[model samples]
Target: MMRPHRGLDPGSVWAQRLRQLEQRLRTKEERIVVLETENALLHLKLAEYQGLAGRSTNEVLQLYAAHGQQMKLQRSSAVTQLHGAIKRLKQDLKSLRSFALELSKDFQRQSKTCLYQVLAAVQGIQLQNEAMQMFQIKAFDLEQCLQEVTERYEKEKQKRKALHNNLIELRGNIRVHCRIRPLLPFDDSAGHSVSQDRRRNFSEKVAYAADDETVLVKCSRPGHASVNKTFQFERVYNDLESQDAVFADVAPLLTSLLDGYNVCIMAYGQTGSGKTYTMLGPQFDGNLAFSIEEESELGIIPRATQEVFRLISEKPPGSYWVEVSVVEVYNNEIFDLLAKDSYGKVFGIKRDVVTTREGKSDVPLLTHETVENASEFLHLVNKGLQLRVTHPTLVHAHSSRSHLVVTLTITTVVFGDNFGTSWEDEQTSQRLNKEASCTFPQKMRDSKSTSSSRASSPVQLEATEKMKQVKTRLQLVDLAGSECVGMSGVTGAALRETSFINRSLSALADVLGAIAEQRSHVPYRNSKLTHLLQDSVGGDAKLLVMLCISPGQKYLTESLQSLGFGTRARQVQRGQVKKKTFPVPSKGK
Candidate 1:
């Protein structure tokens, strides 16, 4: 620390300091010159700034004064414009308030109108609902009235049917309806072969249907005088009459059959007449059975069969059953056409006629096929017809050699109390009463003490109301046409057949004649045909005989004979046709 002054002296330090001062003085002077120069430049810059400030101050003052005056003017104008805008806004607000009030009144008026319309609609709906209710009540009343009217109509229809049945019954049960067949080609040829002068003079019209009930046949004998014979019958059909017209007259008989009456419809005529055609229409080539599609050509039997099933279908189900049996009387012997042998072949079988205690004839061991409808019934009938003995004759191409009889047995079972009390019940009651009234001796009573004790007990009575069975038979007979031996041109067996046919026809005529005379001993046993038709000819059975005659001069004799038979048959009257009702005895009776 003390050695710090050793290097330089104080004096030298002072001298150096003075020298540094002189140099500093000189540098100061030079710096002062520089400062002076800088000052001058500064002064020059300040003077220019002063000049620019003076000019900008003057411009700013002038701009400030002008802006002040403009602001004053704009303030005055803004005050006026604001006052007008406030006045327009107030007017717009007043008009909006008035419009809102008017809109509210209009809304209230519209709301009132909608309310009135809703009320009117509600009232109209209520009126419509009331009217609908009234209409428903009237509709119900009308429906009830219509039902009553329908019931009345049904009752009247039933009454009319009953009266019609009675009227049919009033007419003779054995009725003869005569039918005149049209002239065939053979008849025309035979007539043309005769002298033309005689043909024109002899009147081709040998037979004429005078009226509904009379037929006039003029006998044209070669040697004998011409005798005009008038025959009366229940109904007479001319050649122009259709099968429908013919069946219309016979339809009532079928109704009676459904009513439980035994009915028999027979066709009798000479060869080449229309017996087969009347009972069975023109033979179909391959179709042997009746068809519903062939309604126009349907014969009496087929129509009757359809009608029977139709009437039965109208009744309650399971209340009735129909059975059919077909048989032929050939060579004075009864043969079942539907009979089956042990080989299952339909062969000729002999059948014997048996009489019941009720005076009904039955062919025992005959095949009775139960049928349901018309088709099935006609099928069986056709099968039997196929089995019938038919041969070609000079007079007729397909002539039936045997008499065919189709029997329809209808058994109706009625249940419940509507059948009434049975006769067997009455008989049983009578027997019970008699047993109760019977008196026995004391010793005998002692011997029969057990029996007496059993009798003393309460006897169990049988059911009084029983099922009733009404059995009705509708017999449709197609008798072999009677043939003249000379005209038939037959020999050997054919001759024998003709003889049998004539004999049987004669026997039938005799029976009818006997009935007409009211003979006590009617020879019904003379022939099988008459015996089989005993009920139809004499008993209380409805019968219709269609006596077919050819309206040709060649068959004048046969036509007259057929007309005579019809007249005789129409005269033989039987009692009223009563329905055959029998009480089916209960089991173990």
Candidate 2:
């Protein structure tokens, strides 16, 4: 497996190696000749070095002798200088010893002062440490208390959810929040354009907020017995309370609509008692325009719309949809203010309301305008408000002849999912008013059955029920102010309008009385107003009756009546509050 290269043979390799050796021998001989020449040069240099070395030794001896003499002279001079320096150093040492002794005495005195100060500082630091320890102990206790509170809150989370953001009045009861409207100058038979002094003299305030939950009505005449009645409500706002303060209590209910509860907030008051001002803002004048400054004066409606949309904005995209229906109960007949003509113009359409099988009142074929934001909702509301029936009466210059009911219908959907009815308590009283049942499914069945000419499979109906959208209603009712005919000085149609308003309000009162009495047959159909509000009052809906009161002696009688109505509403024990949820549909459909 091994092979020699082309020039390779043992003999040739040996001859090549010998030639290389001969070349190396010639190079060695040349090197030896160079070495011999170098040796001769080195011998000459060594002889020269010996002669130079001898001369250098002699010169070194001469230099050493000369240096020894100079050293002796320098040593003598250095010894003399050392003696002088030693004497001076001895004297300087003595002076330094005395100065150090003086410094030691001063240091001892200064150290005494410094030591006392240091001790005081140490004492102060010790006190501070003790205070710090006490503070730490207190902080620990507070932390423990906070932790306990958190635990308690976690334990009661369910019960608290019924409250829904500490709105305690929402607990299955009609919360009566009394608002004592301030005594404006226009509260007299004369126009409101008067001097400040005249306005003050005309105050004659009989009704006022006594406290946060009490309304005081004190009326004293020289010839009559004094009357002072104190009534308790959920919240009582003074005449001085701002619109924001009044709505703060109401704002909580708006969000509950999204949580699956039908919420109704009604303003109950007499004519010219600031009911409209409390429900809406101040009346629009010529331009129907207001500034951002007036935004503070906006009442529950605009603000509530804003808050609802704001809450909706926080939800998932397209999770919730809002539709608005503006209805006015005029002349005991309901008119849809938001109704649109075929020409795309809005006008009042006389609409009829019927009770749902679930005992909830709903208008059939009513116009519900879907709104995107607060501005659109308010635009629609403004358009509807323009169609409201108003007449210049002796009592109110701009008296609303009809009850304006603005309902915001909130519809939300979840595909292929079930809405839980866990909030429906098992021990809930059977005697309770018609609860807002799991009715979206009922609605689906009603729809499926009504559309049923042909037979469909169970799976199809189930899909329909699942795909059904659940909606809740937020009913904001601004009732027509109750007024006396003789005092109002009305004639002709004014009298007729007054008669209808009084009758509808009386019918509302009668319904409340029936509910309070727990009568078997509630006369909800007696009046359009009553029939329309049947579900809100009788059903498990959040009903907040904001009783607006005039703070002047002029309106004392009407205020008392309104206050009594609110009291009766509060007394209506219709059982616990429940959500109008979409329960699982029955299979019978």
- Top TM-score hit: 2
Q: How many residue pairs clash in each candidate?
A: 0, 1
What is the per-residue lDDT of model 1 for residues 162-238, given as tens digits with 9 covering 90 to 100? 67556656755467788887666666444325676655543376888887678888775668898888887767888
How far is 126's C-alpha from truth in model 1 (Å)?
66
Error of 2 at 305 (Å): 0.6
TM-scores, in order shown? 0.61, 0.63
Query: In angstroms, how far off is 263's CA in candidate 1?
Result: 0.8
By summed lDDT, which 10 consecutive residues of candidate 2 come out lowest? 448-457
Give the RMSD in angstroms, all C-alphas superposed, for model 1. Answer: 34.5
Q: For candidate 2, what's the RMSD?
A: 24.5
lDDT of every predicted structure (CA atoms): 0.71, 0.73
Relative to the true structure, candidate 2 reaches a TM of: 0.63
Model 2, span 1-589: residue lDDT tens: 1122455553344345445645655665565566556555655655565565555455545654677766556555654664565556556555555655665565566556545555555565578679989999999999999999999987786575445423534435677889988777567653346566654544678887887889999977658998899998878999888988988888878777877888999998888888889988886321224687787788888888889999888765444667778889999999988776789788998988887677677788677666778887888888889999999876678999999999887765543344444222332212111221232234333321111111111123343444434568899999999987865778899899999999999999999999888899899999999999988888877899999888786666788899999999988877777765664243465
